[model samples]
Target: MLTGIVEIVPGVSLLKGRLSSHETTQMLQAEGLAESDLIPGKYEGILLLKAGAEVHFQDYNQEVLRALTAPNVAANTAASGQHAEGCTLRRPRYFAGDWTGLPCLLEKEGLLATYDVILSAETVYNLDSQRHLLKCIKQGLRPKVGQAWIAAKSYYFGVGGGTASFIQLVDRDGTFEVKAVDVIDDGASNKREILLLSFKA
Candidate 1:
């Protein structure tokens, strides 16, 4: 099932996704797809899916897919087989400048709930502030159990940050262990990688 999707800002980081309208709702109707076939209460189905409950979706409006499924899949996985307090939904917050101030701000807002997993995509483009970024992650992650998933190009061309540079910082820290989760070479010049970071045991 498709889960969270983000839009990356070049030279900055990732942003929240906005679903666009579909131009061909007519074709779906012509295929004999009826509204009755769709699972009633889109948001209700979304909540159930987030709770690790499977919702057998027949067919529905394509544009509403994300509106109905924006809950973090990581939360679902983290909550799986656990008790009620396992899931979390971290809202999008604007921490535009250096991340050094992020920890205090999040804490002040009473939003400092730590998690078992955190996901970031295409966010390693700033070289100078890498330490601050890691510091913010350290402040909000559960010490031994939390893992950060970073998906990015192996190297960012014009920018100084990428998976290698970020991994170098993480290795130098000695607090976290880095592992190569996956590498995708989509016939592109720079291959993409999924790196997992966990506190060293």
Candidate 2:
């Protein structure tokens, strides 16, 4: 039974499926394939398949050869039992030069419920500002989460150091401590990296 979205087709991710044997038979019947059209090939009985279910999924295609000897004769190496969401993937990248360009992204994604990323003297949970952080992320403001998420430039730091480091994010969502968007040698000092994001108070 196909419960969710995303079913992998031979070429691309298919957006349909998960019908049962009777359902497939009905569909085929509607398509003009009769009960007699379903003959004994390899599968023992008639062919009854589902919509979202796949070729070897339930093995009721009614193509006898498929039902009876398909399994032992054929081998499918594709990942099984996994549902794909296809084009339903989420886009998580946004940017803007100032705070004025933040709110739209937040409102569009409807993420004004929780979360925050800003600067202040008090603890985040106690702050009184809904700076609209999610908006910033939608406007192409990619935030490097975790230890650090910054936007700096390429400038030799001190003497013998790696690329210039500036931004950092501390979200403990188990994915990243930080992610770097852009790098500038002294971007932060010159206000070159001046994108700020925060949540509701």
CA lDDT of 104 in candidate 2?
50
Q: Candidate 2, residues 1-201: lDDT per residue as tens digits?
A: 423333244423322225577965765665323433343222221111112222221211334333333332222222342224332222122232223444454457564322323221111111111122222333332234312123322332343212222122233223233343443445345322322332212
RMSD to native, candidate 2: 22.1
Task: Indicate the TM-score of model 1.
Answer: 0.54
After superposition, candidate 2 runs with Cα above 4 Å error: 1-97, 108-152, 155-165, 168-176, 179-201
lDDT per residue (tens digit) for residues 1-201 in model 1 = 333434222211112333323523443354334542333333322333333332322112432333343343333334434312454433222332236666787688664546566666666866876677788778767778988888888888887888889999999989899988999998956889999999999
For candidate 1, the lDDT comes to: 0.57
Ten contiguous residues minimizing lDDT sum, candidate 2: 121-130
Q: Model 2 Cα displacement at 18 (Å)? A: 52
Query: Residue 22 lDDT in model 2?
Result: 93
Best-matching candidate per lDDT: 1
TM-score of every model?
0.54, 0.18
Instruction: Identify the leading candidate in terms of TM-score.
Output: 1
